[model samples]
Target: MTDIRRIWFGSMSKTLREAPLTTPNARKGLREGVHWRGVSAEVHLGYRKGKRVGRWLVRWRLPDGRYKQDGLGAADDGLAADGVETLNFEQAKSKAARYVEQERQKQQDAGKAPIPTVREVVEAYAAGRKARAMKQEGARPDDAKGRLSQHVLSHPVAAKRLDVLTDEDLADWREGLGAELAVSTVRRIVNDFRAALNGLPARTLKRLPATYPMTVKLGLKVGEAEPAAARDGAALPDADIRRIIDAAKAVDKAEEWNGDLFLMVLVLAATGARFSQVSRMLVGDVQPVQSRLMVPTSRKGRGQKRSTHIATRVGADVIESLRPSIAGRRSADPLLERWRHRQEKAKPGARPEWVRDSRGPWKSPTEITRPWAAIIEKAGLPVDTVPYALRHSSIVRCLRAALPVRLVAQLHDTSDKMIERHYASAIVNALDDLTAAAVVPLVDAERGTVVSLRG
Candidate 1:
């Protein structure tokens, strides 16, 4: 049993009370429920004919002047049934007010257009970049798609609506990633995100977030020494280079390694060109008369063309060996063609021989890793050594031979600052030899003076 009270409903006053389901007055309405005037609606205590407990329901007027109804739960019974709790008269009134407010908000939201998600924007940007890359001639593979899918789209932040994205949300995501990724790698990914965001259509995103949380924050000043790993990898010693080259030659003789693989090692050791640059060289770029090799632009920079002299005898010899294979091809043809795979040779349309044909350029020098690793292992060199180490070794050789850093930088199409940073210790060692040549005579002269005095 519950007390009866008088309550106002919009403009009219009504009697409100809670009563048993069997009361004749409770069944007077067509809906068959004991209804009470609530804060924003008429709260009803209703029963289905066969149910033990009655449910609380609310009927309210929408902004459009249409009546809407919703069920809150069973009426207050003190005990919870099957994990469903009942609400009292006061609780029903509060719930009804909340229901009405929620309905109004839903209606307001329905009137506006939907916003894009972070993932949707990223995906659109990636698709656009991929399409542009495909349209360009000789475009390198676009890695942005893979990177965004793996690092950005997979993140929880991708679920956030684009319009509601804030700097704090981005900062939290960045901070979370900082625990697992290196600062440099995080900076690269963040820059990738910025690039993606900038690529979005002006109509889609009018402006970027105020703060880019993943920007590098190492506090490093200009001219500060970079971490050793950032500068370069370990340079191969002369002994290791010799051993590896000899092993590659032996492997070629044994028919386990391709002749081109051996020549690639020799050329890399001689010219100091990056793997990508060397892999993309065209036969016409080689000039035996001038002893120069015109290196094309690669993925390193914005594809700036550079020319480097093939001063080493080994480089000249390797170039001569490759001349026979490239003699008849057009100047635009790739110098190094992709080797025929063993499995491909057995295919129906396979070529009769494995000679270098005009099929096209090898996609990358990195594809030669299988044979390169075998040769390194056979030579007992460090297993961790990579193809880039050959370039480092070549540069260090020039430094040791007293070559000027300016000439080396010009040859490699890089800055003298880079050479000094990576090979400073080697340069210092070379200077010691120059200093010894001058100091040794002074020491000999002093020794002679001491002998003459003793005599």
Candidate 2:
């Protein structure tokens, strides 16, 4: 038999404190609200719609043999509850008792509040994530905001309240996204939206269909198709790479673009570094004496905030070409720089008006795309080839040279797992020659026959 006295607290703070009602996890298995015996009524600590702060309600037995209930205040779950507005367990019980004593006389009832919409939740989630990212060392908060704004906030389902949102509604919206976006892009958007939903109250989250709330057990199905980078046209041949570099030099020389496109393309190929990483390199990052270039850590993905560099060795001739950029310049000077310009409206064939001379580091990777298109065109490469192909080609070159996967990963500033995942074909080709040395000739000594197994 269970002790009724142990289940209910009466004028005792210790009883309320010791009960499994303090933490969210502890109260998860309990009913909607945990009750305690209060003066002339029962004090109930009610959990909210989501994992938000708990609320307090007082239930009284009326003389007509009916129960009357009214909300008192919020329970102190996350924030410390003050006696008047927010109340602790003991304070809540006392307040509930007081409210019941007064309310039982008048028989008053509390009205229900409005529920939050999906858009509201997503906005709050984005703001909180952005703020935390600003404080954290290496978090990409802008990416989070971008995903939510472009996908969730713009969707029709954002207007639907959590209480009314159904599995079908979520599926409709997700499918709509898939219709316009790539499989990989749709997957990322769905993931980001799911992360935003995690901030909702536990109860509301539970109300969502187990499979459709983007939970792994019952989530939306995304295709596991091979990445575009794994295709045959992803990487350029070594002959094409050389031609591209030569063509870049020709374009820069003829167009008088100050060798910016040429140097940028050279460093990108030599280091196998991303455009963003190479654009951030300083004059001091180029070590002429050591024939190496130090690429900085990327700000795109999640990692530790580091000032360290990934040292990549290049040819002596490559280092020689970089020496002129370092001549009589500060170590902090950008290695590859260009003259910044604004498109001023010119009167029919007339020279454009003057703007400020701002020679600084490249602000974005998009700045190089136009020049890269021209370089590729001059090199007679495919029109569809992107600058990212250089990174793929570089990784393939190292794999072709029989460099260890771990060593290649270190130089390229990515994981061996990623390299293996994207470049397995290149890896298999490298292994074929390496495994050839271990092969031994077969002998037929038992049959007293001399035959070559090499055949």
Candidate 3:
């Protein structure tokens, strides 16, 4: 029993004659019998001047600081409670709770503001997001708006009342999404919808049923092994990685690209940092003394964007190759910058084009596509091979090498849970390799062992 109920029972005498409101004498001695708090209502026993029985009364406190009162059945005094004509303390509290909920529902129906629908909640959330993002520069509020418009705004569930939404309704919608969308995409949609529900106004949220689906209940994992195809498809062999690096150097030399392509590709392979992160690196970020590279993270999610760096260990050869890029450069200068090429109309009314070229830091990943394509062609890699494949290969290499998952996650700037979630098969294989030594034969004839060694 709960502590409050325990106190109610423990405080009473065993004989029941002296227990609170159990006997005729106990009921007549007091003006009011006893009271206890329910969820949002309170139940009290009403006593008469000379009767052995009392009536159960419930009081509901409203938002306007007013209390609404109602009568339940008679409190069990001389007879046992059947939950109909008479009620025990526990039954009375339960009945009062149900009554309060019904009254609240009635008030909601009659109020000026109607109960919120899925569409309303999602739109409000998107609007609020945009308003908040306006106060903080660079925040992308349209992400939520775009997702909701595509997945929810046109769906049937969007018109349904939030409080009446069933689990099956949500499950059906999620299952339907799996037919046309990737598992990761469905998971993102569900998470975004849940965030919208949570972002609703406090009054609207209070009206939602407690059992509403606020999270994806079905298996949203990419697959049984979870994204194994994507992981396997993106990763390359160690030999291929070496070939790519060599090809990058050769392409830079042949194309007169100023070694920027080779160095950028080298840093990406060695550190496994994203293109955005690598683009933000400065000369001081290259720690040749420690043989490490301090790469900045992209901080993709909500909240204040703070500059965070992950110190990734690299080989001495990588550090040596990076020194030439950093040599004679200011500490704050971009580590890998090159001349930018652009074209503009020669005049407002003329169709002729003018070359507008200047040198500065790399502003976009598309800037490297030309050099990357040449490198891929030189290495004889697949036409579909992307720069991000290098990151996948780097992570797989670390896992196959049996590096600790925690350390690998640190180097990749992600959580161990994320690592396991995305690379379950790789992690399982690594575990198998780690535990291979624990397997021993039960019998050893060469040692002349006899009988069982088991305990």
User: Please, what's the RMSD in Å of model 3?
Assistant: 10.9
Full candidate order by TM-score, most accurate first: 2, 1, 3
lDDT of 3 by residue, 176-202 (tens): 673777666776787787787666667
Off by over 4 Å in 2: 1-116, 124-147, 161-169, 199-233, 305-307, 343-356, 440-455
Tell me the TM-score of each prediction against the true structure: 0.60, 0.65, 0.60
Clashes of each: 0, 5, 0
Clashes of 3: 0
Please report how far candidate 1 places residue 157 from its true position, in Å. 1.5
Local accuracy of candidate 1 as per-residue lDDT tens digits, 1-455: 55576654556676766444433334333243344443533434333321345566676665544556777776544344332356655565566665565555456556555556778878888888788767744455677888788888888988987545655656666665645766666666776777665555654443323222222121111122237453334788889888887887877667644566676776677677877667767778777766666765444544544533333334566667667657888888777664554322545776654554434455655566887888888898888888788888878887788888887776665779889877888888788877877863333474565332333
Candidate lDDT scores, in order, read 0.63, 0.72, 0.72
Q: Model 3, which residues run further than 4 Å from truth?
A: 1-117, 120-144, 159-169, 175-178, 201-204, 207-233, 250-257, 297-307, 328-330, 338-342, 347-371, 418-455
**How does residue 181 of candidate 3 score in lDDT?**
75
lDDT for 50 in candidate 2 is: 35
lDDT of 2: 0.72
Best by TM-score: 2
Quote model 3's TM-score: 0.60
